[model samples]
Target: MADIIIKNVYVLTMDSYELTQGVVVIENGTITEVAESTEQDADQIIDAKGSVVMPGFVNTHTHAAMTLFRGYADDIPLDEWLKNYIWPAEEHLTDEDAYIGTKLACLEMIKSGTTSFADMYIHMNDVAQAVKDSGMRAALSYGLIDLGENRSADVELSKGKQFVLDWKGEAEGRIITMYGPHAPYTCSEGFLSKVKKEANHDRVGIHIHVLETESELNQMKQQYGMCSINLLDRLGFLGPDVLAAHCVWLSDDDIEILRGRGVHVSHNPVSNMKLASGVAPVPRMLDRGVNVSLGTDGCASNNNNLDMFEEMKTAALLHKVESLDPTVLPARQVLEMATTSGARALGIKSGVLREGYNADVIIVDMNKPHLTPVYDIHSHLVYSASGSDVSTTIVDGRILMQDYEVVCMDEQDVLDRARTAASGLVERAKF
Candidate 1:
């Protein structure tokens, strides 16, 4: 018998095509059957009532604990924001603070239909605990920033390696771990090399920022005599196991290197625009066969939420304007970035609602005014649907939210603790 059965839903399998009246059977955290109809019984059943059912979203990159700083600092340049506000405030963050903040982030993500995410942040053990308590799947990493200091590099590397040893493949395989070197500008070549060596030794992936701004590119050129992508390539950091966020300043050569190395790109369209970062040549990267996934960066920079649906819409619209071609970044492609491409980036098997895939799925209420008269399901999903429309979120065959209510954690308690934590963090930061 299946563990759960979801029947009579408008399903976007995200594998090849859509099914108007589909039924899914999940057992042992894996999809057992997906078809137009199923006669089998299950321990639990969810009558979707014509709701739209699809694979749960995979957030390829984010600073999950920064949910505390969502609106604390905004309307500033990325460099200034980090130098003046974000970093200093982060210095005052404690493990408890991270736990509370991450709880809030998980709640928000669950409500918005995110089942899995890749998070780079400080105090990641606490973040992992939050993920466990909230029943969310995540790829966790400790943000390693050397800042050109040998001692800092040593300590950061030790912490990062220890984190991987402690938590990689933990939480019933719901949590994956990676090594996160903050960026080329923040970490030196030697430090990144050390991280790369350790990541290879452990057989895990590396997550790093690459060329997110013109200033960052210029600084990398002046210091390393090459663009950030080539510099990393020379350091042997480009590979299939690397997830590079923000290629907003890449040249054609950079795109070629990424494609050749089989590196994945996590494109944060909303955050990039908010920070005035240049538009990444996503169409060109796609043409080169680069797997470009979608993300909403730290909530501090994104200024309020972790909504992949909004990211999809903004990504589609942004590329159209950037290339001055209406044919760029179609709705279907953006949706793929949010689902299948994101799963591929994280090296997971949960993005498609198909047999044998992980049972991570979501149900979006289509009985709304905005979702009415859906001429095309994909078109409406990309151009009209909002995160608020999600009625259920499931990860690893467990329902975290159902009927718009989070079931894993106490929603009110998380919000209350988040408010308290954010207030205390701001006060401690003296900002």
Candidate 2:
């Protein structure tokens, strides 16, 4: 029997040029059937009320537990923000703090229609537990930074590999583990090469920051005599299984190298702009057939929320203005960056609505004033709609949020705990 039935909705399959009023049947956490009509019986039926049903948003890169640091330090440059504020504050973050903060982030993501995210942060076991308890899908990694210390490097590498072994396919296959070398500047060449070898042996994906700022490029050149992209390529670190975040300072050769290596890029528009980092060459990358996805980064840098709708809008508009071409990144392409491309980057199978796909879906209320007069659904989704319009969010055939109410956890309790935790962290950090 079908576990859940969703009927009376406009289904955006996202696989092809087919948008129609249809029905979707979910059974055992996978889509069993999707058609224009259905007569199946199910445990529960979701009447979508003529709303739009599509795949849930995939956040390619983020620091989920950093929700506690949101709005703590803003209007500062990236270097100062990380060195003077974020790193010191993070030093005081305990495992319990990570749990509480990640719970808050999961609540916000559920309400905003994000089903899956890639997180690199401290206390990853706490983060993984939070994701498991909240019923959200995620790729978790411990941020590995050696700072040129051999002992610290050995400890960090061991922790990363242990995390992969312990949690790679845990939480009923909803959690994926990856190796997170902080960046080219922070991790030595030997450490990076060792990580690559381990990732190859374990067959897990790698998540790392790359070329996010001009200063990083200069440092790489002075230290290693190559750009970040070239350096990674030379170390045999660029591959299809790698998710490189923030390629904002790439040259043409860097673009070509990324395209050639099949490396995925997670463009963080809001964080880049907020930190005064230069814009990424997204249009050129797209033109070269690189798989470019979207991410909101951490809340400390973004300073507000993890809203993929806002990211989509910002991505679409920013590139057009930068390229002096309005037709550069259209609405459909931007939406794909949030959905299918992100799934591809994370190597997940839940970003499209089709038979046998994982039932990770969301319903957006279309009866709003802003969503009225919808000539093009894609355009309205990218240009007009906000995260508040999400009426339902489902992950792996389970409803996490319905009618703007999160079902997996206590909303008020999570918020209250997060508030208390953030205050305590600030006090301890003395910032």
Candidate 3:
């Protein structure tokens, strides 16, 4: 019952084709028409000034509220980071802190041109509420870690079940819930088999970490007598609905297993490289017909900022250098990993800018210094544009950000709350 006309834009339109520019009409949170619209009654008009309009970025896996822990632990091995710094800090988090931290993360994500993301963490009720308030689309999962005795496992399972019943598919259907069993090392075979049963019955998807480190690969091999992927495969864990993050240590057989099972992989290039997790064999995954998407992992590991542009650039160049082939993961394919492929990975219907797709869109300001002399817009977008270059963001036909200001959130208030939360958490964490 409403119309917003975005005009005079270089519209990237991440449709089936590569780069195409045209007008888009958004009505009631769904794109009614894109390009060559004959009807022109508009309620809202945004002059893009030839800025690129593309599908909003889909962050395939992240811990949104972990922004509070950014730089709290760094330059450490994955096991050390988890056991020494991150887990200790996480134990001190309150629901209020999660709310504030997720708000800050959502603000940063929108500003950086991400409309939708998949998140895995604890206190997901706070995270989901924050997503609803910020008007961002997300798939949230309560991470189930049964590291303690059997009692601890029961507690985790209870919390995860409650999260599924309470918050799944909330926020006007902008949010979907998933089951997260942390990873292989923390969860036992019996626990994971139970998780698979829960997933099957609940008919919900799963978001999990997979082969993120050489340690993980080694542990699975030594402890389980199988590769990590094979262990999951034996448990029937990989599916079309399964989204596995950071396949940095996957082998050729592992890639085949994932492809055969239709498992979606999220390539967190920055986070992996930062953790020295090694290259993910992204080109090999692509060659094997895997649905490879993009993600920032978490601000803690990625440093800060949720800019998919930087992630895309890293994904593109990292593969080429790792494979020693210039033709590996070109700009266009890297762009797909952030947009449509990302959507596909998350099992969402709105990756491309077209009719019937959800109105998830971002408008970039092309007048910036780095984006000038626009020879190829896609290349420039992947290689040059930063998160700050995004001028406006629209998700579900509602303008969440315009002229670099977020409409659905108060950035200053979030900043204050997060600062307070961080100080308190540090004190309570005994750090």
For every model shown, the clashing-pair count is: 0, 0, 0
| lDDT score, candidate 3 | 0.88
lDDT of 3 by residue, 332-425 (tens): 8898999899899877888898889999999999998888888888889889988999999999889999989889988899999999999999
Ranking by lDDT: 1, 2, 3
Rate residue 200 of model 1 by lDDT: 98
Off by over 4 Å in 1: none
What is the lDDT of every predicted structure here? 0.93, 0.92, 0.88
Q: Provide TM-scores for the models.
A: 0.99, 0.99, 0.97
Q: How far in Å is the alpha carbon of 429 misplaced in model 3?
A: 1.4
Backbone clashes (count) for model 1: 0
Report lDDT (Cα) of residue 430, candidate 2: 90
What residue pairs clash in candidate 3, if any at all? none
- Residue range 88-149, candidate 2, lDDT tens digits: 88999999899999999999898988999999999999999999999999998989998788
In model 2, the runs with Cα more than 4 Å from the true position are none
Error of 3 at 427 (Å): 1.5
Q: Is candidate 1 or candidate 3 better by lDDT?
A: 1
Clashing pairs in 2: none
